[model samples]
Target: MNDKPPFPGDDPFVDSPLVDSHCHLDFPDFQGDLPGLIERARRAGVTRMVTICTRLRQEPAIRAIAEAHEGVFYAAGTHPMQAAEEPMASVDQLVALSAHPKFVGIGETGLDYHYSADSAALQKESLAIHIEAARRTRLPLIIHSRDADADMADILIREHAAGAFGCVMHCYSSGAELARTALDLGFYLSMSGIAAFPRSAEIRAIFAAAPPDRVLVETDAPFLAPPPHRGKRNEPAFVAHTARVGAEVLGMSPRDFAALTSANFDRLFTKAARTAPSRSGRQE
Candidate 1:
């Protein structure tokens, strides 16, 4: 199943040390060209990817992708919307399935109010289960809070107070207050390439004031593609734009930005650790 190429490359920007903290490499959009897609990502400076789990039904497909790629990693949990289909992916199931070495994080799970309101309630319940699994497994939770900030906050605060766990609010589209609550509970905020868009002033503002150690960059790829590639399917390589944009927001060079956020990713998602070569694979 291994298809990774260790050969050195010809591209300049492809050698930087950057990581795309989240992406859906298992999705059908990527299924046709897993090897080439991963190669392109590597050539674009993306060395690692946490392929997300959206439904319990898709775990096998996602696992297969991770098994085939050398540096690819994955998570196991039904996303909020999947609660309907997998009404029983209990905290125990999440904790149990997470024993696999490649199962590094606990979710792409959290509230997403873009659909049904009933789904929102189901989403919140699912989030609690993932949080509990995260607490038990001590893996960082990959949160996906959307328009339900009030509910999302209430749940995080309540569960965190009950028993603490590592968490990262992925793609953070919420406001300052929600960000404050997540930070107050020791959660890292993962910024996607969306922050690079001109319309992301509020998201950038949150990044401007976030604690350095608590800020991580992501692509959420095959979705959220950065500028220059906006409206297209995103890939791990696009994480470079996130680091670049994040650097601008934090007032640092992209290299320093890459190093900083890579360190932050390691800090928060510890068990999913990495060791890059001295030569960073990402360049401007």
Candidate 2:
């Protein structure tokens, strides 16, 4: 009765459940063998995945993947880098498109000073659009912040002031204040494969200190693959490794980590959806 995004199906990880809240399963890397990859993930206990959007131009493809998979869901928005280059999806477009039966969130948007610190105007403009879309649709917005905590925090604060909305700081690697601010603003901080990196001791501490209910896990697959599989292309199945590390850091068992995080995902991303069954298969 406590599960979330409850869909029509049985879940395999009822006891040790985990959700890869962010990934790009629609990318070309999975095109040739999408079904097979998804099947593999199902056997590995990844029952739900949010195939995030990088550009508004790719929303259709992202939507197709979500529609084809029972447990797979999607978000709609243009990435910070693409917002200027590609045709940006207007707030109306995002709200309308994200209303699809399988779509449950908005964005993969936020500042990325790591890539383009020189263009502050462009990044801020891009982020505001997606934030407004999230507000309009009342969907959790997936954010990708990198090397720009102050601006990111400011924007989130500003947008949140206009109206209350939720968002995830996707693959968080920022300092404690940013995490704290995001938490204060009612945002979820998603941890990725980076947590287990030997060099990320400081970041790992920040992650450990985050409020568990406000934390989420992700593989960010096709990137950030975790330990024992760090060098390989990332996938949803490897979320287990990330979960294991998270459990170790938070002083909980992997199974407990699964249960708690799954509950957390439901609370954050699938608020409108029902709790999925305990026997649900991998949503690659």
Candidate 3:
């Protein structure tokens, strides 16, 4: 399962550190090598990373991963694709998990019609529950939508109208309409390595049109590695590549884009920003 490249490129943007707002270091692909993977991320200017827990039952292990690493934080929720299989999550359960100091975000949960259409209803129920937990805890909900733009937008809008909660559309590669809806809702749109693909002009344009402060970047790693490593396993270190493309799309330098996304991450994942020690190991 160790498909990570021998070396993730050199730290070209070391002076301009950024955060990988979404990644899953607790996944089997990173087992036993978490420390090395994190160090690689650090050397490549990824000052912090948020490891996500896609199953509530796995939260203990995922939380342990964050506790063992200095700059790593975690979020927990039942992924939409697993909605039909796992027990529906409750808002109270999620809020209680938020009591942990290292638990910084609410979910990587949302609808996923493309792969699990049969579970759509369950996914929506789970999504609503997560929304309520985020509202209660005042933590950003990390959303994952795929091929369900209209429904996704409707739920987000409906839920937000009920009560305000921060959010980020993690690894966003959906339609421009969904992008617009998310941005209009004061939610952030995160750019992943997919946006760096040569055939992703539309995706790049979607990001380009977004307000600079409303954009974020992620690797979704051990998954979407950006160019120079597109088909290979991804890692937090490679977020620099996606950030480079995001910068180009926004007509800004890589450094500025990194800073912008980091700020957006901090704004959305406020608990992480408040608790994570500054790179210099002191209060900011």
Candidate 4:
């Protein structure tokens, strides 16, 4: 007569329903074990997850994955690094994809000059297209910026002035000025596992300075796994470790921090929040 939860680990935070605001569950790493992996996320208190599709052609597979999982939602767009190779995504194509109940956001798109500076122009063009899709669909754009703070801030400010759209700077590790600009635009800043790295003091300060209500949490799993699990393969369940670090950075208890970020996620990704069910085991 053991009636506890089916998952193994205990969530240190109480009544703190967590959401892995960004992940890539459709990637090959989770291929044959999606169900078990999702259950692990649930056991760790990650009740919802948003899997991102980096290329439009992969949208069908990503969409099918979202359709198959109750707790999963998805976003699709041309990632910056691939902007040069992939066909420039049209706003119409993105808007059409938004028709699905499980499609909750417009992008994992934006500028990335770090390794793909040669395609900066293409990335900006693609980013603008995604912004338009977000504006039309009224879904938040999940942005991925890197080593292009000045241009990123300038472009975001310019586009926002042209027409307002919600956004969350996914896996944010950019400069403080960019962070300030994003917050000023009424957008969200997501804290990822990168924030938990021991050498991320400057990044930690950037997040610490952000308003609690404007912050969100993500794993960007299979990429940045946070400490203890750092340098290893990351998964949605590991988001709790990042949350624990985020809670410390914000000087709040894990429960309070988890609650705060979850509310922020809802505020930005309203579609996901609105569609999510009330209980754990129920389908959305």
Judging by lDDT against the true structure, name the best candidate.
Answer: 4
Query: Per-residue CA lDDT of candidate 4, range 139-190, in tens?
Result: 9999999999999999999999999999999999999999999999999999
Candidate 1 stretches greater than 4 Å from native: 1-15, 274-284
lDDT of each: 0.80, 0.80, 0.88, 0.89
Name the lDDT value of residue 202 in candidate 4.
97
Q: Candidate 4 — which pairs collide? A: none
- Give me the displacement of residue 113 in model 3, in angstroms: 0.4
Using lDDT as the measure, what is the rank order of every candidate, best first? Answer: 4, 3, 1, 2
After aligning candidate 3 to the native by TM-score, how far in Å is the CA of 69 from where it should be? 0.6
Error of 4 at 118 (Å): 0.6
Lowest summed lDDT window (length 10), candidate 3? 275-284
**Candidate 3 clashing pairs?**
none
Model 2 segments more than 4 A misplaced:
1-15, 275-284
Q: Candidate 3: misplaced stretches above 4 Å?
A: 1-9, 276-284
For lDDT, candidate 1 versus 4, the one ahead is: 4
lDDT (10s digit) by residue, model 3, range 129-170: 999999999999999999999999999999999999999999
Expressed as tens digits, the lDDT of each residue in 1-284 for candidate 2 is 76432221133333465688898998777778888777666666777888988887778888888878778888877778775677756788887887687788888888888877776678788778778888887789888888999988888888899898988898989888989899999788888999888898987898888888888999898898887677888888778778878889999887888888888899887642463633244222
Go through the candidates in order and give the C-alpha RMSD of each one to the true structure: 5.5, 6.2, 3.0, 3.7
